[model samples]
Target: MRNLLILGAMAFCLCVHVCSDTQSGPQGDTTLPEEDGVLQLKQEHFKRALRKYKQLLVHFCKLHSDLSFKDAAEALMGSEVKLGVVDVTQEKDLVKELNGTSYPMVRLYISGDIHNPVPCPGVKTVLSDRISYFCTNLHRLSHLCFFVQELTNAYSQVFHAAAVDLPDISFALTQNEEVSRKYRLSQDVVLLLRKKLDCRKHFKTSQILSSPVLNHALLFVNKSSADFEEISSAFSSAAENFRMKILFVLVNVAESRNGRLMEYFRVRDFEAPLIRLVNLTDHVTYHLPSDTLNVEVIQEFCQSYLDGKAKPKMQSEPIPEGWDQKPVKELVGMNLEQVAFNPDKTVFVLFYLPYSKASRTLFPLWEELAEAFRQREDVVIARIDASANDINLSTQGAYPSLCLFPALYTERSHIYIWRKKYLKTEN
Candidate 1:
């Protein structure tokens, strides 16, 4: 969902529409000749653009973000928005300056802290360039610092509201002389404070299993399966419409205590953010089918459920007899959550297609992998038919793949499954 204020597509990669690659400047450099609408930026250019475009939409730090901002670029083309592009790899200092922290999961959280921020390039900001400059640069001349310092306080709230949805990031500005000197600030600079916070620091682990959430016949569980500071602010906005009708709840799947909720919905192996609706009255549950979710998707899911049109999610296939008879334990949708994510067991799963020759060839290797851990109750080597079940693993579209779900679970230990190359015939 795009927040018009920051156009904050939280947790989404930006897709910018680059009309032409034929238009570029200097080979082997992060430079592009100034196109009227698309300004290629440098350190000097970036700072200048910040001042020039009060509502600038920049495409810098082009790893996973800029590509999806095409629509954003197109939408804001001529209106109040200014456009610029920066390749962050070539501008490491710029990223550091903006306080951009690249999480290992690849969910780059640009500080939305108005004092600092994150973005398609670095972080998107609504603060005037003058305020941002004055806040970050303590080395500026005396009078220049004094004039802009007054302007900073006026719009602090406006900027904060825009960034309110950002996951656990905060900002501060300092005018203290000692503070400035301690940090070696420029004679003319003001300091902005920054602090990283854990959003779930005080949340009770047992809240999900509580009676209020489960007993409510119509419930919306908006969960972030990724282990990061998740932003569920969009749901709050979505919740406004259905006030008392559908009780909306938030769940963090990363915590070990919340694993039961994931298993309860059979979404333990699913990787994307999940939106599940439970109707205790009907003794059934429905989950949002789409991989990508937005405010619109959430509303539709809720409306359909209330209207009795939404279909219940697939719980699991019937357990296959002799499922664990062989060395390579077989998994179906029913038993996947129980086995694959066992905190006590180090599980290695080979997701394969039965019809593929490559998958058939991996059987011996699979057996060997299982045989190696046969004596230990802790390690389980298993396989599942990628075609037969509704497992929502992040990796897909290929076969004979391996994923190790380790016993020592942590954000780092989670499987970063490789996407296997698929044969044309299979497609």
Candidate 2:
């Protein structure tokens, strides 16, 4: 596994390097013509040519292998709008002049206004669909989409499409008066959106239950906000030591309103301020022997888990008949797209084998989520047996897989798959 990951990383780097070199330099025999749509801009010809286009869309990318870069370039091939590709590595001075710090950066130049360039808003990665959406509606909206206000029909459609297409990205609305005043928001509203990391700090009950990180949840369960803050601070300080190797989360036992997880971990109500490290992969756990939770102790606990010296503990959860209820609809090939691509709702689908012990064990958790969100009108939770259904869904190598299909306007709907590792053992 380690070798495969290393090889994958190396291959990715090589692809990036080769692509960067090709785009930065000249194509061997087949050079793209200016009319081909994407213009290759350099330090020398950057300024003069940019001013010529009435509306210009420029993509500053360091690598040719950047999927978003390629996607955006293809989306604008036959359009009247001009697309420019700048290889940042070869044009360091030009990138500096444009004040670009991130690679695969995209900006729009309109009406020969080189002084104030309009940046694609709420964009962290170069998504072709998102870039095209933003550019087509650039004139009607603000230069940056982050400004809070009423979203135009086109803008809303694009924003929601991007959110559905990219599961890691979350779109949030902030209506705080103070925040609006502080930011001087034009529309008295702020659209907060960003790509979420897999190892983000806090985990709500719904997220924890649905997350693959349930296999290895280093939970700091606490009753008081003060204790939660203290333990979270300590974990944050020690988190860098583990990086992506482990997931650290804070579970406020009292606030989350989810008692099943506490029961699964056998955390008593009296044990409010406690730290427990669960290894769902092995069905074992390690509890902090001491009451004092600090950065040093947390680091030591993590080190012990890595060293495989942590003692095993049994998980306890009461199995009820209601737990066996099927809230997740079984999806077949014929109805898969019909149900998944419903324009009114976002669908979360789980793919699993009926006979697999691991699948059976996790089914209750998914049911619990379905029951919890049963009242929601905008979401649908469903499951499909992979053996029975031959449809291609992103599994990320896990048997019992979960994927989210968002309802967006596109020829093909994007599926967001949960790629976290799952336990294969029956134990």
Candidate 3:
């Protein structure tokens, strides 16, 4: 885990302990004193908030620390600037509340005793990003709380570290129109970084886009409804970025209605090898603002996306040669020493038991060749009864079939023999 600088902590601690700190570097460190009866924030607490704000702070506050925002905003009745935590454990109720409130409700909506959903989005985010976003938009607490709760859990898995909890930090939300617009922009950026990407694992800008074996690129859009033709043209250069095989997986956070647009743009149903689509919402869109992103959820989301579920296969055939062997080694252990003795010409030997039905048929034919070829100098033949030994082989498919290379054993020069007659077609 990386070390994070709290509101006002030693600068060195934040730098040296950045094991999981995604947002690196030091930004401006500013603070204001408690002049009036309003709550006075400690320097340590303020630094933590500053770091979070600079790195993950989506909105910029025009009113500096000395501007006295709380007193001024309260005086303006039509202001859109808001600062506070919004609890959205009751998701529908919270939305209803926001519908009536003024624009830019800077509430940090926390999950307050609400019904959970499937694949509960794990927490994988670092502490700084979550708190920075949380504190900055405290006025929209309900939106923040609802979204944060889910994102926090999801991010927890990615950072694999604890967030510096700011239980004491307070924010002031107002109805300032300019502040609201700025906050919206900042929120969009935060969502882009937090939701669309697994910042801990994804390739950075340093990685080369064009290569012979594999090529990769990242495409993002403001909304899911962005035109497909525009996107295709925008990324056209990337299509020619590789030589051999190019694989593209588009990741986006869009409205559910845009699902069809994504499917059409990516040609998802055809399952083309060159392009793919992944919806970030499929993982944690339902999360409220206050919900923390944790590492566990990050791991599960990553694992599920990277490792697709295995499906059951229906039986296609009855019995085939080499199907009975549980493992290839079981069939290779038999009569190995005897097969090694033939060095003049290549000896194609099979190791199988006579009792197995597939082996029973293959062993007799092999025996006839062994007898005929024993006196010949050009070829040698042999068989091993795997059943006689303790080796296990799978009987689900083909069995007793000659393998090309069985465990690369030194017992025989080759596992399968081919006659010159087979080579006449190659020339």
Candidate 4:
């Protein structure tokens, strides 16, 4: 009972807090302090606070400006969250360190992301609305860090390694009875403090809107499905090991409240018991091919992802048979990177629509251009069906476009050299 109560508090804690952090940079030695539940933080305080707090919300404001968020900050800060304010006007150095040139900015620094703070928006809204807005951002939940306290250790080195790898999760093993009394746990059993995100209640409209950019893993299930409990248990167990690396969520396809999320993921009701993982940074989504959702299988799927064994869904068509048989090699999505963008070879590509008259007129000219470079093993000429595939470059999206990826080209800073003089079209 005591353990259960404590878990409840931790769950409630998740709904009130958010993130912030700064590295241990050289600063003047001064004892900064916390008063009225808000830390009067300086440049040096962030390093200390980074080690102390799991979730932090920092408000950067001009001291003389309107103190509109004072009450909202107080209401948001609790045992779960530590609130701090920086006087941007006075601490010009701190402002620069935080990469800020403006006042009245709110940034949340979570445990893992110390160098980059997540910008907290909707600060200028009403006090009630501000709290409401903060509550709905699924990322800012009841408690930032989860704690599992018991006498017997229920987990092994896998859990320990995970804790070390992801400092965002707080795990503790204690043989203390007093801890349970607070939460009312009486028996000696394996109890893990955890929070599960059910799409019906956890995912708000804003959260749904931001799903593409979020590191999200979702299990879509049906209430009437016979394997629902087994799958749910396995998914939750898998989620424990991933902590800050992934935001694991579940959705009931049968519930109308979850319909919007289902549509967003393009999940049909007939496709219950499905699992998918999405990368937040790259916006890539991977689907699990198996229908079985067991502990071993789910963990393997997650482990494979962490090991980079899974492939993301990219826009590409199948490579045609003997793609390089012609003078101008025909390229597809699969071979585009290795052939057209080869670092050792200077490459040129013609992106054309086969059906376009203008595209047809360039075929003979393209063949001549390819023949010119055919003898040079250091250079290659290629043509792709642009209308049938995506080149992933903004400027190369249009049909009848020409591009050059020289030997000096880079993945981050790629350029296209389009030659517009060879304009021949069948009128």
Judged by TM-score, which candidate is best? Answer: 4
lDDT of model number 1: 0.55
Scanning candidate 3 in windows of ten residues, the lowest lDDT window is 113-122
Deviation of model 1 at 65, angstroms: 50
Ranking by TM-score: 4, 2, 1, 3
Instruction: Report the candidate with higher lDDT, 3 versus 4.
Output: 4
lDDT tens per residue, model 2, 43-115: 7777665666666778787745533434455665564456777888788888888778576566777666776
Give lDDT per model, in order. 0.55, 0.61, 0.33, 0.66
lDDT winner, 2 or 3: 2
Task: State in Å the error of residue 235, model 2.
Answer: 1.5
Candidate 2 segments whose C-alpha is farther than 4 A from its true place: 1-215, 223-225, 314-427
Tens digit of lDDT per residue, candidate 1, span 320-363? 89999888898987788788878888888887888988788878
**TM-score of every prediction relative to native:** 0.29, 0.31, 0.21, 0.39
Q: Model 3, 123-150: lDDT tens per residue?
A: 1121224344324433442322212333
Candidate 2 structure, TM-score to reference: 0.31
Give Cα distance to truth, residue 278, candidate 4, Å. 2.2
Task: lDDT winner between 1 and 4, please give it.
Answer: 4
